[model samples]
Target chain A: MKILVVDDEQDVQVLFEQRFRKEIKAGEMQFVFAFSGENALAYLNQHEHEAVLILSDINMPGMSGLDLLEKIKKTYVKPPPIVMMITAYGDAENFNMAKNLGADDFLTKPLDFTLLKEKLKTIN
Target chain B: MNFDFLLIVFVARYLRTALKNTQQNSVWDDRLKLAMYVAIALFVASVIFRDAETIMAWVGHLCLLGCIYILYKETFFKPAKSLIVAILPYAVVATIIQFLQLVLPSFYRGNHSMVDSLKGFAVLWGIGVWMVTIKQKKELDKTNEKVVQQEHDNRIITAMKDELEVQVAERTAELTRQKEALETALQELQSTQAQLIQSEKMASLGELTAGIAHEIQNPLNFVNNFSEVSNELIGEMNEELSKGDIAEAMMIADDIRQNLEKINHHGKRADAIVKGMLQHSRSSNSIKEPTDINKLADEYFRLAYHGLRARDKSFNATLKTDYDETIGNIIIIPQDIGRVILNLITNAFYVVDEKRKFGIEGYEPTVFVSTKKRIDKVLISVEDNGNGIPQSIVDKIFQPFFTTKPSGQGTGLGLSMSYDIVTQGHGGTIKVETAVGKGTTFIISLPI
Candidate 1:
């Protein structure tokens, strides 16, 4: 399984890489990193159907996660990739909005990598 | 005739005594004395010239007319129509008796002595009547004087009352005008006070949001993730040890150690951010203490940068600092000075950010903060490479409520408050240097 992680903070890349080191070594999962939603979309456009799951942070400088999700859901409908939104605010308004925008899942920071791994396992 | 002469002498003596007792220093007194002398002369002439009785009588009549003229000229008794009418009949009868005595002796020779005595008696009666009329005129003069004095006092009282009423009206109008002015000023003050409170609340909210979202949250996320990763690494290490893979366990142990250090570093970062926020929120006690000026400036610079970045994620600026090694801890109110430093740095960043948004060609936004140790003072400066303030408004920049920013965007009190904190609270001087289209620098000089 291939996954794309999008966040504004560069440190999230290191954290994700370290947390999934076992799976990466076992060759069961592969991860790609993008610093912003716009970069993630650019990556997706260059390599279509390469990633099975997209984990993105909602709050960003440009091209927020919800916009990317809406574009992805609208353009890639035949083999829709699962998109999970992560946010510091876990308010009901954001949750409902994400749900209405066809987000596959919602996660609140500080994220639980164990639960995320379990969910990835179920998807696999 | 002898008895009449004696009566005239007696009346003249009585009038002289009355004039002396009254002490009336008037022309009327002199005239009365002259009349008394004339009456005495007439009486002596009448005795000396018994054969010239007609000449004596004529002289007596002339003296009486002179006395009447003096009385009229004195003006002490203004003769009214009623008093003149009362004396008219007496005056006519006296004149008729004098004429009859002079002319009837030739017509009726019978009882010539009786007629002469009758003439003397008539003369005495007329003199007595004239004396009584003078007394009555004096009494009337006294009553007239009292009436005139009362009228004068009444006119003065009336004039005084009119003046007092005018003054009262003027005072009431002045008081009313002052009351209206005070009420208007009070209303304006109340409205301004309410606006100030509202702006204060908004400013604090912005600070709180920036501090919580960027300063505390970022490091806290790192600390949590690093610790969780370390926990996982520890579990993996135990598993490898149980399998008797000593080399793998050592590798995992090393990773955990590095993770622990990262965790410690991130934890301290979060702790420092919280402490800085607490310091800002705490009310200033205005107590002077020894503080490292360089460290203080550096800390506030980072805080203001992060705060601005938290609000506007696209904002970017290069920060530079120069600190004098010789300048150590200086005694100052750290909190107040910190606020002043923060305010200046924030303003510097704001101006540069505004210029950056203008998309000037080859423009790079930069902020420089420097501290220098002078002979007997310390100087702190914040400089920004942004469009400089116009010369027209530069002088008014430190005045309260003076701002170039649009209304509601800025409370306009930030620079003024900073000026107060630097100059009044810390006993320092704040000055600004700027050049058009180049930049602005705010310098603060503090006595050692």
Candidate 2:
């Protein structure tokens, strides 16, 4: 399985790399990282059918995860990739917005990697 | 005739005494006395020698006429106005009486020689005329006295009126001066009061903003710390799994999972704080409660200073505080006021940190915070010895999006929001004074 993680914080790259290091090395899972929504969109354009699951932070300086999710749902229909919305806040408003924007799932940070792994197991 | 000469002498002596008793000052008076003496002396001499009657009689008549001229001068010439009316009437009567009696007497009194004393009617009429003359003279003297007194009275009244006018003019001038002074004083007082009110309002708003920022950071700090610690723990867990320590790896995994839960909980808390901040700002629903203003100020002052110090180790500055113990507690939105104090102190710290980095010789960075309790209000001041704002940019400091700081370092909303809060929320005032190289002081005032 391949996964794409989008966030603004540079430290998130180290955190995700460290968390999935064993999985990546054993060839059980592959990971790609994008620092922002714009970068994620740009990467998706090049590798449209590459990532099976996409995880994005909702609150960002520009082009929030919800907006990205909406764009993905509207543009990609055949073999549509699953997009998950993640945020620091688990507030009802954001959950509703993400659901309305056709997000595959809603998650709050700091992410429970165990639960995240369970959710990702059924993605394919 | 000898006895008549003695009587005439007695009459002269009586007349002399009466004239002397009047105590008048006049050459005319003396001449009248001399004429009286001449008339009496000649009458007496003519009687002593009966044969010389004709010459004596003519000389006496001349002396009497002299007396009349002298009397007229005394009556009419001395004062300016009184006897002019009397002079016409008196002169006409005296001349007609004299002409009728002395110049043409026999033609008028009915030609009766048998009543030879009927010509003596002239003598009777002469005596009556003399009495009338005396009465008239008295009246003239009375009129003269009244005229003199009226003239004196007019001068006194005129002087009194002049004095009153001068007094009135002086009083009016004094009143005008006092009115002008009072008006100026009132204007000065009004301006100062307006400034205090503006500062107090800004302070409250600033507190609101600072409270939001500080409150949000707390949960973020927890998440960041926990994440870092969990990463380290995960590393241990990975190593334990590699070593095939199954029980140890499980325990470490459980610990990591617990930390992750805590991170999630804290993240939600941060979200809640942000939402709450927005709600509070919108609803204006915070209740004004009693809080210790001095304690609030002192607390925020330290928090701002320490918060900056923790972020940048190389940044150093001295903090000074003066709190008015008398301002025990006051009614306010404590969280809101706290934010204001924090912003001022943080801004002060930022400037001082900048100055420390610049490495200027003989320059010491210091921030001072003070609170004062006026009779009707509270005053707070934050002072800093750093790079003070320039004069040209001072007026723009409180405008939204107007900042001297570089783009990334500030949102430029701090001072503008502070201005709104102090002025509109708390009915307060904010003031700033700065010199480019010296220092800056921000003053906030809130009415009790």
Candidate 3:
């Protein structure tokens, strides 16, 4: 499965790469990284249906995680990719709002790779 | 003959009573009595000595006239024209009687005696009228004196009342002036209080912006540390694989796994710190939560430094920190405590930056932040190697609206607000220590 990870922090790319090193080396998963919501949207437009999963952070400089989720859910109707939101704010308000905006899943940061791996296996 | 003597006695008695009623001095009384006795004696002599009767009668009339003059003079101070006019008829009658007695002795003896008696009666009647007039005049004088006394008393009372009114007006004016002055002072105090509150809000907003720059470093640091460790581990594993040492390679891989876990742990800590910061930014509520003191102090130190750097690019200061790790987490209102820390660190940076601008040779600007756990309290101190606070103004450093910064640059509420947050808000203590030229340190102690 191809997964697109979106975060403002550049070091997040390296972190995700290292965390999924075994999966990538074993050819079980391919990862793509975008440092902003705008870049992630641009990548999706260039290669439609290329990314089966989109992981995004909610609090970014521009085009917040919810906004990107709305656009993706509205535009990509055929075989729509799964969208997950990650936020430092784990409050019920943000969770409910993201859920209402059609977010497939919600995760709180310091993303648990163990749990995330289990969830990814189920999606497969 | 008996009627003449009775008439003379009656006139004498009337004069005595009038004199007594006049209330004159003893001298006048004595003289009037002598005159009365002489008149009576002469009358009695005339009755007894018939040959010299006319001469005695004339002398008696003269003596009565003299008594009348004395009485009138004493009562009125000077004899009035009416009294003199009343005595004139008697004097004229007496003179006529004397002439007739001298000119016609036999005829005068027959008719002149009757005329003389009638003249004496007339004189007595005139004297009675004069006494009555004197008494009336005396009563009138008494009434005038009483009226004059009443007018004088009324004038004095009016004057006193006017003076009292003037005094009341002056007192009222004075009180009004005091009230207006106090009102103006109160207005000024209210405006200054408003400005101080506004500046505090501005300071918190600045801190929030600086927090973004300071918070990103934690996750980045974790990523760098683990990445370098994993790189070294991969090299070791590759060498063991080339040497066909599979067990050793497996051990190295396990170690790498532990390092990755550590990286994950640090990443979670960064996330938690970010969440706390976001919560602090959102809520103004003073809710007590378990907070890491060292991390809080270190976070604010960097936040203040970065905030200053953003404003003035040329500014530079050496930062140092010594944190006590045993004080893991203490219960406190993290937002309030975080604001206080940010304020102190910002002030430290400001002082050091000011000293740096002086460009003193070999002078290095530095700010040091430290935390320690005592037996029952926690101490956080911020120190700056800048020109120390003068002894004279050291006590006023934490006073509201007292500032050393120039106009428009500072509101002077920073330290005062910090003092309130630590002391009044949290039941803590804040104090300052300083030297003339060395440096200054502010210490805050919070109960565990």
Candidate 4:
């Protein structure tokens, strides 16, 4: 199954890949990383119905995960991908903002890869 | 040489002196005028009937008694002008008696025809003196009438001055009241002006955020899509590698998969941040509704974390939550209180992040949010383990425009606005407890 990871920080993407290196090597899962909300959209427009799950950070410079989640929920019709909001700030307001925008779940960083992997396994 | 002639002379002289004294002095006693007539009769009777020694002695004694009355009137009653009239008659009587006793003593030795004749003349003289004294009293009365008129005018003038002073005092008090009211109105106007400026700033921020969010989302969706497809192709290649097809896997392995995954993850994170920025920038207005305290706290925590993460990517903090299920839903304006929670959490994270940069070891940044119900109040506490606030600045944290954060990172209004939200908006209390090295805990109490 293909999973999309969205964060503005390049280091965050490296951490996620490193943490899930075993799963990717075993061919059990595949990971896609988008550096920004704009990059994520650009990748999505070219290849549709590819990402089965989206793990996104709530805060970024230009386009945020809640906005992206809103667009994904609004535009997609059938069997939408599960969108989980991830933030370093475990603030209740941001969590509510993401949930209200139709996020499937929420998490905080330094990415709890164990829980994230388990959560992703359920979606898969 | 006769007793009656002597009496007549004394009565004339006494009448003349009494009239002259009444005219000279502004205040005179009316009793002095009546006593003068009694003195003339006493003197004539004492001289003409000299053999009636007892009657003559009684007349002399009455004259002496009048003199004593004059002395008493002069001494004790001197301050009052009214007492002068009371003593004037006594003075006239005493003067006549003095002349009769000293000048006509032989006439008082026995009764004689000449003395009898003299007594009739004395009566005539007494009538003449009474007429003259009456004329003198009229003249004095005219002068007294003028003095009374002057005194009346003085009293009226004094009353007018007193009334004017009272009016001035009242007007001054009214002016002071008006000035105080004007000052209060001026303060209210200044506060309104500040609020208008804040609203204008928020409006511009909202518009800018919405535009930025819209522009970023379009390109972000594109990157996310293509990255997902690339990952799928990489996955298919990985499947082939597991099935013993290494050549195809090698062609697709290093470049496409790595870059595409980077685009997907970070792209969505950027999108979420822009969205949060847009939502947070919205102007605050009263939106009262029933809200779950626990859920509200969780949302603000995430927003606070996102805000801190956006500033510095390396900041890491461990967060813990202990929500009391008993503290159920409470009515509130979510955004207002949400901002409060967001500010506290952001401050907590900043404290930890700053501490870490200074090579502080043996301590991991920790934030604990706990909720509890006590009687009729719900308490929400945000506790942070970091370099605690300094003693000098701790008391000033909730004051408007006060901050310990670096200039660009803090507007200095975060804690103040939070205080307003908790105390004024929600009718609750917000307090902070901190130790120099231990950490800080912000406790918010809301009435259920």
Candidate 5:
């Protein structure tokens, strides 16, 4: 399973890498990263239908996760990647918006990696 | 042949003088003229009717009485009230002539005609009374004219007083109306000023809120990311332990420690930002103390600059400060004056930031803050080398909600409220000097 994580904070990449290092080394789960919505879209453009799951932070400097989710849901029809939205505030407004924009899951920080792993395993 | 004729002549001459003195074109003039003619006729009848001289004497007496009455009418009845001399003689002569006519039949018949002699005496008496009445009438009319003139003057004075009172009342009413209008306008202005200040506060609060939101996220992100990754690393470390990979578990522990340090640092950074915001938002200016104006100005200048830079990473400007060390401390409401100084510095920073956005090659955005000690006042000036205000809008800059900044970028009450604080609140003066395309200087003077 290949996963794409999108966030404005660069530290999120190191954190995600360290968490899934064992899986990445075993070649059972692959992880890709993009710092912003634009970079995420650019990555998607080059590797269509490559990522099985997308995890995105809702708030960013430009092009929020909800906007990216809407764009992804609208543009990609054949075998669309399952997207999970993450937020810092855990607010209902962002949650409902992401859900309306066809996000498959919702997560709020500080994240429960155990639950996230369970969800990932179930989806797979 | 007798002395009575001499008296008669004297009365005729005096009658002529009275007529000449009172030559008025009225009923009194006609009456007085007829009396003069009657006096002459009485003298002629005395001569023609020597045998019926007694009847002529009576007629002469009655004619003289008529003349005196006319004089009374002309004198207007208020003066000449003490004319007993004329009335007493007429009554005595009339009574004596009637009694002698009844008692003595031979008194009328004499060789010299006793009736003619008596007639001469009556005519003389009539002339004397007429002369006396005329003299009294002249004196009385003079006094009457004076009284009439005095009454006339009094009426004029009363009318003028009434007119002046009315004018004063009208003026008072007009002034009251003007005062009421001014008071209403002042109240309206106060309410509008309050609303404008609130709006300006809310606008800046929104910007500060957004800045805080952006600032807190970076640290919070580190905290969130590290905690979650640390949890995963613990799981990985357990797995390594289960696999007997003690070295790998130790390495993961070291990475987690480094993440914790970053988390702690970012958390503290967010805490500092919140503390600064809380300090700024507190609205209290009641207490006053001696404050170092130079130190206060410098602190706000840096605070405003750093706050802007934190919110906008691309914003940059050169700052120059010249603070007077001799002007140590002045009594002031530090918070209120601090707000004014902060507002000025923020405006300076905004102007410089705007100029920088234009990307002019030779433009160097600069802001200068200075404090100077004068004889009786401490002067603080904020000078900026940004895009100076245009000449037309310069005069209205201190007006409430008057702003040249783009809509949603500024609420425009910064300088207006600052002016109010320095002037209305502290009895100080605020002045602005600006040149188009050159620079602007805002000076605030606080009296020692």
Candidate 6:
């Protein structure tokens, strides 16, 4: 499965990569990273129907995660990819909106990779 | 010039008389007046004793006459520029006077020689006056030099004092700026500490609430399930009763009725408290967006006061709101500001609650929340009518871990966190004004 994670913080990307390095190497998951919501949208526009999952952070400069989710839900045609929301504990309110916008699930940072793996396994 | 000399003599004599009458309290030196008196007296005597022919001869000797005029001019007329042209002339006039004293005896008769001798004596007296005036002029110049030196020293002292004043002012301004910065830093430190404490408190509350919720959820599930079962049983019993099986129907009805009572007993009790905890924990986590400040304040006011009421059944206070209708909307994190308002309102309620405990009959606690707009700034104010905050403790109210409440009752993080929200988090200001018995007002100013 191809998964794209969008976040403004570079350390968060590094953390995900470090946690999932073996999975990526084994070809169980192919990972793509975008540092901003706008970049994520542009990537989705270019590679439309390729990725199976998108994980986006809610707080970012320019376009936010909720906005990105809204745009994705509205614009994408065919079987749209599953999008999960990632937010801090203080921002738990957006989960309902994310679910309303057809998001797969919501996770808070610092993410529990073990839980993430279990959810991914089920998807697989 | 001669008229000026006469005026000087008359003025000096009058001044001397005035000084004597006043017991010489004047600052003017005595030698100057004395010299003026002597010069005037000698000048009058010389005029009266002059030989008409000899006076003509002296006039015919222009150099001698010029010398005498220069001496007179320097000594009695103008004292500044006259000296430059007067020195040589003075010496020449003195020699001519001496010569006239010697030669006039030969030109006159034997008896007239006595007059000539007297005239010589008068001439000698005139020379003596000139000598005396020259000496006085030297003394006057010395005195002037000393006055100039004193004036220079005074100028130096005045300049030094001016420089010192400027330095002191600069230092005072620098100290004031430093003091303000320190106050700001102290405020920021307090805010961060409060936030940390609040987060910790919420964390603990979240754990406790979740546990309570789970425990309540189980009992609620049982109530709901049993209620449905009892309702089914009632329907079945009614069917039996309709079919004329009366005993079986009555027995079933009793069982159903018993279950219904149990459901009513436990269900409502668990639900109310659980719902309250749920409301407390379910803080919205939406990101900052354009939100109406007035609405935000109202929401927090209700939640905070309601939460306090739940904690203490006796906590009752009147709340008044004065929101500026024109202060539209601002971009801010609604959740954060909501929490801030909740904290402030809660504190205000607490203050009023404490006051109500000790308040006199017919006195009720009151909390006022208000908002206003001024140019590009918005002001939000919270005030309370209670036993006013103590003077000594008012400044420490926003300090983290500072509270009048007993240990477990208050962590003292509310106002500190609110201060941060109004100041650093939003680039605004928070100030407090209070009187000992009149109550306290906290005003928050934020950029629009």
Query: Among these predicted structures, which one has the highest lDDT?
Result: 1
Candidate with top DockQ is 1
A35-56: candidate 3 lDDT, tens digit per residue: 7777999999998999999999
Give the Å shift of residue B191 in candidate 6. 3.9
Tens-digit lDDT track of model 1 for B1-448:
4333344345445445544535353655576566667677778878988998766666655555444444456544344223333333333444455576678856446655665666666555656766676688688778878898999999999999999999999999999999999999999999987677446434744644574566577778888898889888889889999999999899888877777877787788778667656666556465788988898788778777767766665576777899997999999887668777887887888899899899999787889999999998999999999999999999999988887777877778778878877878878899999998899999999999
TM-score of each: 0.58, 0.38, 0.49, 0.44, 0.52, 0.36
- As a whole number from 0 to 100, the lDDT of residue B289 in candidate 5 is 83
- Clash counts for all predictions: 0, 21, 0, 85, 0, 1
Model 1 lDDT per residue over A1-124, tens place: 9999998778787788779989988999999999877799999999999999999886654466777788989988879999998866544655676788999998887888888989999999
Query: Best-fitting candidate, measured by TM-score?
Result: 1
Q: Which lDDT tens digits does candidate 2 get at residues B39-115?
A: 56666677787786644544444444443344447543333222223233333343344455556678535543533
TM-score of chain B of each: 0.64, 0.39, 0.56, 0.48, 0.57, 0.42
Worst 10 residues of 1 chain A by lDDT: A87-96
Worst lDDT window (10 residues) for model 5 chain A? A58-67
> What lDDT does candidate 6 reach at residue B179?
100
Model 2 has an lDDT value of: 0.68
TM-score: the better of candidates 1 and 6: 1
Predicted complexes: DockQ each: 0.22, 0.03, 0.02, 0.04, 0.14, 0.01
Which residue window of length 10 is worst by lDDT in model 4 chain A?
A: A9-18
iRMSD per prediction, in order = 5.6, 12.7, 11.3, 12.3, 8.4, 20.6
State each model's C-alpha RMSD to the native: 11.5, 16.7, 15.8, 16.9, 10.5, 25.2
Clashing pairs in 3: none
Considering summed lDDT, which 10 consecutive residues are worst modelled in model 5 chain B?
B1-10
* CAPRI grade of model 4: incorrect
Candidate closer to the true structure by TM-score (higher is better), 4 or 6: 4
User: Which portions of model 4 show Cα errors greater than 4 Å?
Assistant: A1-124, B1-181, B184-186, B189-285, B292-295, B308-330, B362-379, B390-413, B423-431, B445-448
lDDT of candidate 3 over B1-448, digit per residue (tens): 3233433455546555645545453665576466557656766777788887666666655664664565456553343445555565665676577677678878877886688787778678667766786787688768878888889989999999999999999999999999999999999999978766766756665655654554565465655657665886798789999999999889779868877876787678667657656755654566888989898888667666655654454566667899999988999888788888888888887887788788899787788999999999999999998898999999898898789999877778888888888998889999899987788999999999
Q: What tens-digit string does per-residue lDDT give for candidate 4 at B78-176?
A: 333332243334335444444565677666445445554554455455556556656766788888898998899899999999999999999999999
Candidates ranked, most accurate by TM-score first: 1, 5, 3, 4, 2, 6
